[model samples]
Target chain A: MAPLLEARSLCKAFGAVTAADNISVAVAEREVVGIIGANGAGKTTFVNMVTGYLKPDTGSISYQGRDITRLGPRATARTGICRSFQIPQTFARFTVLDNMLVALNVARKRDLFFWRPAHDAELDAVAQGLLAGLGISGHRDQIAGTLPQGVRKILDIAMAMVSAPKVILLDEPTSGISTDEKHAAMDTVMNALGERGVTILFVEHDMEIVERYAGRVIAFYDGRILADGAPAQVLSDADVRRYVVGGELHRRQPRKGVA
Target chain B: MSVLTDRNVLVLLAAIPLLIAAGPIMPDWVRFFLQVSLASGLAVLGVVVQMRAGLVSFGQGLYYCLGAYAAGMTGHFVGVTDVFALLGLGIVVAAGVAVVLGFLMSRYREIFFAMLSLALSMILYGLLVKAEVLGSTDGFNLPKATFLGLAPTEQALRFAVYALTCAVTLLAAIFLYRYLKSPMGRIGEAIAQNEIRVEYLGSSARTVVHITYVLAAALSGAGGALAALANGHVDPEMANWTTSGQFVFVALLSGTGNVAAPLIGNFLLEMIRVYAVAWSPYTWQLILGATMLLVILFLPGGLWSLVERRKAGG
Candidate 1:
């Protein structure tokens, strides 16, 4: 089958630092792929380039057999490639339900300028249902900014799911979440995306999350892919063990049973 | 049917008779003050819309003055005395200008947007002062405004203009209310919060801002035409940065609490300024400045927060 997304020989440099260096990867349909790397390992750089947030100095990106290398974030999103930020991006002052409703409008491709009242019985019902599914309906009327950090991240994921995109890119889905709460958060995100059969390429720092959720794992080291395979194989790769996963894996592995 | 059922439309309907009745009984100066207040309130309404999207157009007076000049010039030269024609032309001219300027303005945000807007309004101010036929700095009177085909006597004309001002402002309010409640309006709030996220949600911040700019300009234009009719004059000072700043001031005074807030805020501001100038002519600005300071310190959401707080409490 044709890859859902493909990037070839992606290279990017920011002044003195190399962010993505001759990197290439492809994601299959409905594949739950976890990408791991140390800071500045070019995981985000690659994601940015693919999402049209940053232009890669060299290479091409294609989605579903069409070239999308130069499409901007808005156009890329319209093409069924959606993303959520590392830090939850939300309309902080708007009600949680309002956030979902706006996303729904975009997803449905409704004429945004339609002059009727924004909320009708049917749309509100759908929005409420979506929020309930994300376990955030109780806070429907609350401003998103005031929501707890973990809930905010979940809300961001909820917004991303509104479009039911062909592929979703999540940057650090559990970054600011507490260690105790990360598993629950990831569980909610994974289950929601899984139910929709979304192809996901998420950048994660947690090895356990990468192992437990990812069907395939791609490990990055200093702007290059060090290993790409099943989680156990890549996590145990000699170079990955030496440079990336080493002692941190040993310390966190014992706690893996919680998920 | 939906337009008729809208709450804003209902409010406008209810207000028309009350305003018309009040016009006849109110003292002449009081009637004049109300007319100017309602007209200026419409301009502030434009500011309020841009504010909701997290944009501050310090050059809104550019459109306001353009609307006035458009109306005045057309009435003076074309012999178009029909107030409706002039008002419609003003909106078209202003919106046309906005379509061009919004391309540049929408590309900016925060202080850059504010400064660029201010610069544009000032450029209009400079040009208007230099244009001799348009009355230059001294400005010119608008030919007597006529409604439909009948030119009412002076006292009757005051009431007509006052009634017209109320009706047009209310209509603008109703449309603006719908715009504020539309999906695009919600996206405006989202753009204010996070532009990147708005893009990821499949909307362009620039596109939303552009539409909003044009809408705001059209509104300011309408307000300017109404004001020109009410005051019987159009001056270069109408586009001056100070006039634009006052619109911003009214926006701050109104808050983004709701669409009606700016309109009410404009009325209260005009009332206060009138009283201040009468009671303490030389130091009236000092009083106005102090009141603004107090509102910023004590009621950051502007005067509308009082109503919002009451609703929340209830």
Candidate 2:
């Protein structure tokens, strides 16, 4: 089967730092993929290039057989590829529901000059339902900027889902979240986005979350893919173990039972 | 239809009759002050409109000047005295200029946008002062406007212009109030809040800003035409940076809290200026500057925040 999304020989550089170097990765339909990497391993850079936030210096990115290499952020989003930022982007002063309503209004293609009210009963209902689906409806009227990090992350994901995207990239969906709260936040994000045939690629540092959630894992090391296979296989690869998952896996290995 | 029931909309609608009735009893200077306030209030309304999208057009008077010139020159050169024709032409001319300039203007933000706008209006000011046919810096007089071919007596003519000013301003306020509630308007506010999010949501921030600039220019055009009719003249100073700066001042004083806020803020400024000049003619500008500073320090939302606070029960 043709890959749902494919990146071919992608390379991006910012002066002396090589963010993505000769990297290529393909994601299959309905597959939940976790991307593991150390700090500055180019995981987020990969997401940025794929989402058209930054144009790769070399090679092409295709989604569902259509070239989107030069498509900028807004056009790329319209093509059913959407992403949530590592830092949640929202209208800080608006209430949570208002932010969602704005998202819904903007989801209407080329209606920038429509005379109709942007938030009618229909749009409001959709926003409310989406918020409820993400289990953050209680924060509907609270100002978005004042919300906790976990709730904001869920709100960001909720806004991304409004477009009914075919492929969604979440950059550290659980980052900055308390360890105790990250699971619940990820659960909300994953459950809300668990629709059939939607490809999910999430950049994550947590090995346990990746093992539990992703069907496949792609480990990144210093701007290159170190290992790519089933979660168990790649997580145990020698180079991936040495470069990306070494200290992280040490915490879970059978420390006392080895004797 | 629901827009008509909004409190701001109601305030706008209510002002029409109250002002027309009050015009006959006020002194001539008082009536003139109200007319200038409402006319220039419309110019300030354009500034407030752009402000919603978090854009500050320091050259808003470009449209104001164009609108006035459209009216003034229409009467001065083409001999069209009908007020409606003048106002409509004003809108068309201003909108036309905006459609052209908005391409370059929407590509900028923050200080760059503000400075570019200021530069464009100054360019117009420079050209107008040098053009001998347009009376150079001294400018030229506007022929009195007739209402649908019916010529009123002198007193009635003054009152007609004042009444017309009230009605036109209210209409602009009503349209803007509705716009501020619409999705296009919301997108503008969203663009101001977060341009990246706006783009990611599948809308163009540039398109929204362009449309906003055109709409705001059309509004200023209408205001300029009215000011020309009221003052019986048009001058290069109308496009000068100081005049544009005053529109910005009125917008700030009003706080962009609502469409009606501009009218209230402009009238208050007019009354304060009159009083300051009367009490100490030489120091009136000093008083004006000090008043603005005080408002900035105490009421960051401008004069309208007091009303908002009262409504919010704070």
Candidate 3:
């Protein structure tokens, strides 16, 4: 079968700076992938291009065997590709459960135009079930703005998941989370997502998370993929180590032959 | 207790009968004040509807004026004084304009949207001021409105108009509440909160704004028609910037807390205007400005927040 989502020779630029250059990626069904990169390395640009938040300067993207490169974010989401943000985006004034309900309510376009309340009991049940699965049901009544960082992160992912998209791009799933809660948050998210058999691509700076949860890892440097393989292999690749994982030039081991 | 909640549908529905029952004992001025208030409230309600989607227009008077003229023209040219027909024509005309303008309006946000709306209303004002046949700036008197074929006499006319206004206002409030509770309506608030998130949820923010624009225009149209009928006259002033500003002021004062808020806010505002103008006359606007300032500073949520605070506190 064709890959769940495929981007071909994608290139995007802002003024003289290249956000994504000659980038191509394929996400297969049911695969859990982790992307590692430094700031401004084009990880988010890749996700943005795929989810149709930003159009690629040159390239084609296909989903489920149909061309989706020209689609907008709303159209792409309807085609089963959704994305969550680095900073959680939610309706701050609404209750946490209401946030989920918004996702659920907007997902069903046919039943949306009626005089009946948007807070239908059926959708309410589904929202509650989703919240419970993410271990955030206890905060359902709390205003989303006041939610703890970990809970808000889960809520963000949960919103992207509510549509049951076949592929989800999560930008820094554990970015704002406390160090102690990182694994727990990942465990809860991965386990909940696993039950639904979702294919997830998450960006993270934490090496341990990439090694532990990712079935495949792709390392990005500048605007290109530096390494793509199993976590152990890619994380140890000399170029990935030097350009991505290794923070500074002083931290790198000089090449023996060249020296 | 949830004053901002749509659950107040029943309370809104109940208010109709309660007001109708009280109409008999009311003085002529009170009845006149209420009908005018109810009509203006509908126009302000239009403003609030758009506010839900994080959109505001300084040109809402464009539709209000259009509604009145559309209805006014029907009587002037078509000789149709049946109230329902006039109101229906008003809605159709306003909605038609909104449909075309909404496409353009939907593309804009914040200040651009406000200025564009103001510009459109002023265009109408200028046209109305110049058109000689439509009575120019002086405007023209409307024929007495009749229900179906039955025309109420002078003695019963006040109550008749008052009752009609109540029924029409109630229906508008209820339908608007339902829209607010609907998914599309909720989408407006979501769009207000985060337009990007709304798009990722698989709905168009532009479409929501367009629908809301049309919906608001229709309500303002109905209000203008009813007001024209009640006042027995229509004027270019209906589309003035000050008039549109008044609608915005009433919308902010009412808060988006409940469907009933606009009507209550308009009524209270009319009462305040009556007292202020009676006492201060030339400085009445200063008094209204101070009132609005106080509302902004202390009751930022509008008058409805008082109800919300009491419920939250209790």
- Best candidate (score: TM-score): 2
TM-score, ranked from best to worst: 2, 1, 3
Per-residue lDDT of candidate 3, residues A1-259 (tens digit): 7898889999999999998888888888999999999999999999999989899999999998899999999999999888889999998988998888889987777324847678877898999999999899999999999999889989999999999988888899999899899999999999988888889999998887888999999988889988899998998889987888866333345767784
DockQ score of each predicted structure, in the order shown? 0.63, 0.68, 0.58
Every prediction's TM-score for the first chain? 0.94, 0.96, 0.93
Worst 10 residues of 3 chain A by lDDT: A246-255
Which regions in candidate 3 have their CA more than 4 angstroms from the true location? Answer: A248-259, B1-7
Candidate 1 docks at the CAPRI level of medium
Residue pairs of candidate 1 with colliding backbone atoms: none
Clash count list over all predictions: 0, 1, 0
* Model 3 interface CAPRI class: medium
Q: How well is candidate 3 docked (DockQ)?
A: 0.58
Error of 2 at A206 (Å): 1.1
TM-score of model 2 vs. true structure = 0.97
Comparing 2 and 3 by lDDT, which wins? Answer: 2
When 1 and 2 are scored with TM-score, the better candidate is 2
